[model samples]
Structures are given as structure tokens and as C-alpha cells.
Target: MAAWQAALKWAGEHWSPAPHLHFVPAQQEDLPMVEALAREIWPQVYRELISADQIQYMLGLMYNVPHLEEEVRTRGVRYQLIREEDGSMVGFLGWELEAGSGANHSTALLHKLYVKPNQHSRGVGASALAHVIAEATIAGASTLQLRVNRQNRKAIRAYLRAGFEFEEDRCTDIGGGFVMDDHVMVKRL
Candidate 1:
């Protein structure tokens, strides 16, 4: 059974802005569509850092279509799509809800946010981020947290403009000696 089915409270479905962009909760069928986008977004970076297996592993954890389906199905997390009226997904955002333990009330984690590189600098990212903050606020989140690669200064600036402040530095313990530099940031809602 789907998480929404298992739950007693039903969250609302779907939102639209200006007809050009629609914000909707993810469904199982949308995963492949999102994954295709991720494929375009993922390799632009990871292929330089490690083996193809690790690249695949990273994508699986971050963008596996079925994993996204299961996340929505189990309510561990949920994905949203920002689609054009013509039915193409222009951007995507997904997050972890209620993910932290103890005293972390109303907390959310942004897992992924991507818009095509061609869509850069034209408010595609801003639009998607605005939608994300709105959604998170609706979910009663007091704060939103996300990690970005320290190398991604441009994105860091975007996060800052979106009201996030640098929280700390982090390291992803991939295993053994491998670690990825991550800058943790959070925005209070």
C-alpha cells in the first residue's frame, strides 16, 4: 500500500502558478521522467570525481526513479515537479520530512533540486526554490536544511539569496579515506 493510502491525513494534491508552471506531488510514474533529468544533471560533476560504479551509486541514492517512488510510497520523503503547461517537467525538487531525531521539530531536508543548465540565470532556479520554500512552509517546517558541494559557490550564493545561512561544514564519509566537502546551510521559516 502507498504511504498516502496508509496514512490517515491526506495532504493536498497539485498547485499551479501562471499556467506555465505546475507544482504537484510526485507520483510513481513521474520518477523516470525525473531520473532522465537527473542523468543530465548528475554526470556534469561526478564523472570527474570517481569510478563509474560510484557515479551510478551516487545517482541511485540521489536520483533512482524507483527509490523516489518508494520514498513517496512510504512517506519517508516526497518529490515535486515544476512542469510546463505542455507537460514537460522544467524543474524538480525533493526533500526529507521529519527526518531528524529529537528537538528537531518542523525540520526538512532538501535532497535534490535541479533545473537544466540551459535554464540557468533566468529564474528557473529561483522559481523552483520559491516553490520549495512555500511547500516546506505549508508542511509546518520551522527550518529547511541542505548541503551543497563547497566547490559550488554559485549555488551557495543562490542559497544565500533564498535566506539560508551557512550552518557548518561537513564531510561525507563515503568510506575508508574518501570524503566529500559539504557546506551545510539552513533557512528559518
Candidate 2:
């Protein structure tokens, strides 16, 4: 199979989080919080590696209100929010299941998944991941896939801990003069 084809196939596996994280589907009313998350995670996560232009474009394409609304409406974009015991939105995971022709493949793409910087290493990210994967598994999805910047070791470690194996053959490059250099990862149920 070609590299891209191989990647898609790898993306079609089941994944589950370790434990303790909750997954709640996001609603239109959650748009504000979602937008806020993009804003928050951006400076903390992307500002260092990506240029301002890249940041603007990525955030515009991924987290803008209209984009999220569309994801909620037509796209199978499921938003799973993570919170603290006190009820603050600590992190979130956005994904699309069975997005294309391979319905049985039950593929999912994780568009947004992040935990607050200060909250790192505290299991917030892991819990959110588990919540998202559990939801996908419950929906009968065969695979769960996401693109993590090759340079992001922390996020990559979390995915690996959740049982996702690096899909080196299926990296996707979404052009705009900005390269994702993404590593496709998958886990089987």
C-alpha cells in the first residue's frame, strides 16, 4: 500500500484510555469554552514551535466558532471535555468517527486534544484520552487516529501510554506552507 493508504488503514484500530478520565460530548453551547481552550492551549503549546501566521491559520481552521459548529452539525466531530473535580475545563478531545467511505473501518481523527500546561503530568491528559477512546470504542469504531507534531514528545508519550503504536508509514502533510510532519498512531481494542 502507498504511504497515505497505509496510514488510513493504521488509523482504523480501537483505543482506550488508562482510567479516571471522563468523556462528555460537546454541545453548541460549549463553543465558547472550546474556543477558549484553543486560545489557551495555543500560546502554551504552539507558540514556541509554530510561527504566528501558522498559529493563526491553524486556530482559524481548527477552532473557530463556525468551524466547530460545522463539525458539530455535519461532521461526526465528537467533542469530549475533561474537567477537574472542581469543574473547570482542564482539557478536551475532538474527533470524527467513520468520517469517510470506510464505514466498517470506523475511522476517527483527533482534531483537538490538550491539557493545561500546569496540569501536565497530573493525569488530566491521560484521563481525557481514555474518555475519548472509550467513547469511540462504545460507538463500535475499529480504529482511532490522530496527528501529533513529530516534535511533541509529551503528547506522543501519552498516546503511546494509551496503547497507540506509531504509524510511521502514514504521516499526513496538510499544506499551507506549514508542514504537520505528523505521525499517525493507532491502538487495537
Candidate 3:
């Protein structure tokens, strides 16, 4: 079978019908819902890795409706919703293609992947990642890159299982006296 066919089959098996998971691009109208989910999920997910104050700060910086809308409309980052067959949103992903770096394939940044804490370990993350891979591949990106907090072992393990390798360590000053200390992970498409 062709590579694309194999990918399609894999996605179908893991996400279509049986698993009842679907990835859909977010629209402007979906901003409020996405913001609500992010607010619900981020605190629990980041609690162990960051302080409460930082969590609130980051949430405001990233998940506010205005910021999300700007990201979707102006920044060209794609926001995808993870939904169940029953039409419930469980998670979301963000990515954007980086073009013209003179590489063999374009690089896409996998900005965010958040699954509701209660829904972890149910293959939700893996399926969501696979969907992103297929989407990035279709968009002509040869690599997908993301950063995880250095102390986020669970997420690191997930990325490893999803075929990503640690690329480097990074520290970014995101203003407000906070810094994101992270390990950059990359998956080659």
C-alpha cells in the first residue's frame, strides 16, 4: 500500500468510528469554547510543573479569547479541536508551518496539545498527535517541533512514544518575571 494510504488506514483505525475521536479545525466562533477548555485543563496539567500564579498568568496570556483569536486569524496557527463521537470536546492542538528555512522539508511548530486530565491514557493524546502528523504532512512539513516543561516527564514520555526525540533545552522569558524552562522535542515526518 502507498504511504498515504497506510497513514489514512492508521488514522482511521485509531480515530475514525471505533475510537470515535475526531480532529477539526477551530473557527472564530469556537474561540470561547476553546478558551473555556484551556482554562479547565491547563491548571490541572501545569499545577505540578508551575506555580499557581504562573499558571494563571500563562493561561491569561495564551488562552484568553482575544489571544486565541489573534493566533487563529493573524498568526496563521491552526487550532484543532479533539472531539468524541458524542460531540464533546476533550482536547485541542495548535500548530503552524514554518516555511523557507532552506531545509529538505518545511518545519511545523506543534504549539499546544492538551487532553483533559481525566481522559489521559485512553489513547486520546496519541490519536490527537497522529492527526497532527497527518495534517502537517499534508501541509508539506517534514518535521514537527514542540517544547515541554523540563519537569513534565509524563508529556516527555508521551512525545517519546509518539516518535519525538529531545532536540535541546531552552529557556524563554515570557515577561511578567516568568520563564519557560523546556526541552525542545522534534518528530521528523
Which candidate number would show the highest lDDT if scored against the true structure?
A: 3
Candidate 2 stretches greater than 4 Å from native: 1-22, 100-104, 169-176
Segments in model 3 whose C-alpha atoms lie over 4 Å from true places: 1-18, 99-103
TM-score of candidate 3 versus the correct structure, residues matched by position: 0.88
Residue 175 C-alpha lDDT in model 1? 57
Local error of candidate 2 at residue 31 (angstroms): 1.1
For candidate 1, give the lDDT: 0.72
Task: Report how far off residue 38 is in candidate 2 (Å).
Answer: 0.8
TM-score (C-alpha) between model 1 and the true structure:
0.77
**TM-scores for the candidates:** 0.77, 0.81, 0.88
Better model by TM-score, 1 or 2? 2
* Most TM-score-accurate candidate: 3
Quick one: how many clashes does candidate 3 have? 0
What are the per-residue Cα lDDT tens digits for candidate 2 across 36-116?
Answer: 888888878877777888887788777888888988889867786777656777777788775553656676667788887
CA lDDT of every candidate: 0.72, 0.73, 0.85
Worst 10 residues of 3 by lDDT: 9-18
Order the candidates by lDDT, highest first: 3, 2, 1
Q: Clashes in model 2: which pairs? A: 12-143, 13-142, 13-143, 17-130
Candidate 3 lDDT tens digits, 1-189: 357445644554555322779888889898788888999999899998999999999999989989998887776889988999899999999999874544566899999999999999788988888888888889888899999999998988677766687899999999999999999999888
Cα deviation at 180, candidate 1, in Å, is 3.3
